[model samples]
Target: MSFYSDDASADELETLGWYHYDLSRHTAEALLLSNGTNGSYLLRNSNEGAGFFALSVRAKDSVKHFHVTRKGNGYVFGFNEFPTLQHFVNHFANQPLLGSDAGTLMVLKSPYPWRVEEPSIYESVRVHTAIQTGRTENDLMPSAPSLGTKEGYLVKQGAIVKNWKQRWFTLNRYELKYFKEKACEEPIRTLDLRACSAVQFDYSQDRVNCFCLVFPDRTFYLCAKTGVEADEWIKILRWKLPAVTLSVSSHR
Candidate 1:
């Protein structure tokens, strides 16, 4: 479990600055040179919540800096530029660590300038529109259930269809029920279908349905069981489908 994977030489670490270790707090404190810029900075490691600290050195400065701290059950980000030790303490005092936000302070010890090259919202929209309009018989299509009628049915059990390539799939009553049961057991955050390889759809204990939509980096699942559910799923998918297709196309 260490989240940070910075690899640098011991001499490089020393060049950054001397570190003060706090075993009780599980942290290593040190001053770091901001990249290669004239400015300097302080960095501390909470061991990524573990017990070990890794050090590294830099020859330049970073233009932007971000810090992650524990807050509630997740994490919150703090931003600053060449912050002083006093500023660090005051900021931490006002916003104490919460369980939601847990992690060490990642100090960017550089003033290196950078730029982002993300697609604009309008570009994204245009790309998606093109993808939707470009679909043909050979192209991937939504699962059969999503294209079928919107009627509820009684199911006894369910299973995933084999050789399924396209993302949208349907489930029977039992499958729908199973999906609901599984979804209810987990918190909304944990049940994020975006992170899941496939979503389980439960119509009833005996009927289940699931589908997998492949993405460049990951796969998305649809948890629709009934016709209505399928329709709603399709609507959302249709809205996002173009964007996914466009991204894939751009990469290719």
Candidate 2:
């Protein structure tokens, strides 16, 4: 299934890069909120049921997932029905979508770019579902737990002195540990992911490609080699966090 619906053609799949088949609701929201600007959106299969789809859009400060259901021969979004998904997208591109609130409005500004090198959508969906349900993916799929690990070089700000120093960072399980060297046996510091309140992009520093891991007591500032590297770290770290932390993190 290249697209959400089997009726959608291969041609449509090639043209509609916004259609993310089998993407879980939680994963979709994370992608939009972490990487997209306001009004960025994507379409995906709805968790509600088959033959249903979702419109995940980046709103003012949060990501909203709107239900898209079949209405006879057309597609229904909010109060309107369109002959096709393209028509629905075209209409929303120009018009504002009213939220549940009286005055809240959301518009589709841009489609979040779909990348070819993304990790398995199945694995992402599994992890997201596990987090939401408070169960390990092993329970869901009867496979070995696949908690991911990421290792890279990043500049870290000293907690007390505030001086920046380069370190080898490794994110595994529920902890982010930084080592003095890539092959070092001991980590210089370990930031517990459970204690982490949020992870977000920070530009307050003079250095470029900066992001921070927010703890209740203090924040750890880190700079990657490039913007793409920084985004990768942020996304993986966010995924490994607990559901409550993720919910809080997304609102920021």
Candidate 3:
């Protein structure tokens, strides 16, 4: 018998939307309520094996647009004990960016569910864990054919400094490979999509089209010459790892 012998069948399964869980519009409205400052909000239960976290950068931490997660919803600023837009407003009320006056709230751009995989665990393409003992699940494993190659500039990390180099990025069935140049014999950097659980865009200030590809072992900060290219990559990447549907009820 299979460990998940009682796995949900197609008929038994619920049809989840891009935001996931097919949550009620009311829940979504309540959950994503922001303080109306820089329009930052938290994504609760982003994906399997993860908890509530920020979809955008928190103005308080100044962490940029990278996804930030925590174990509990205790007295955290955005993730208040009583989760509400009011709580977020109250917490950051005094910030220079925010004030007593209600500011404009920015809505989440992508409706697809977001991915935030747990540390040290790659997404298993196979159902049986016993069969995947030695092999790591770094591959993207698209259901159909891959989207193929793209041209962009990726930021290469050095021992101390970071360098921006032009590279050719390829999306294969299992991984995202980047070559130093179009004709490089081998890839200079490889990101296992199965291990990469989350991705964010416009995270840094250096470039307008900057994006972040996050994995357990490392993070790739790639910059595209144009915003169109950055969004183009995000479209295909999110197809595999969508956005999240959080439950702000835990705010209590």
Q: What TM-score would each prediction reach against the true structure?
A: 0.18, 0.43, 0.36
The residue-by-residue lDDT of candidate 3 on 90-169, one tens digit each, is: 44434323221234323333223333344696774411112234544444332322433344455544324676666777
Q: Judged by lDDT against the true structure, how good is candidate 3?
A: 0.46
Q: How far out, in Å, is residue 201 in model 2?
A: 0.5
- Computed on alpha carbons, the lDDT of every model, listed in order, comes to 0.32, 0.76, 0.46
lDDT of 1 by residue, 94-125 (tens): 53322213333333333222222445555322
Residue 110, model 2: Cα distance from true site in angstroms? 45
Candidate 1, which segments miss by more than 4 Å at Cα?
A: 1-185, 188-210, 215-223, 238-252
C-alpha root-mean-square deviation, each candidate: 20.5, 15.4, 23.0
Ranking of all candidate structures by their TM-score, best first: 2, 3, 1
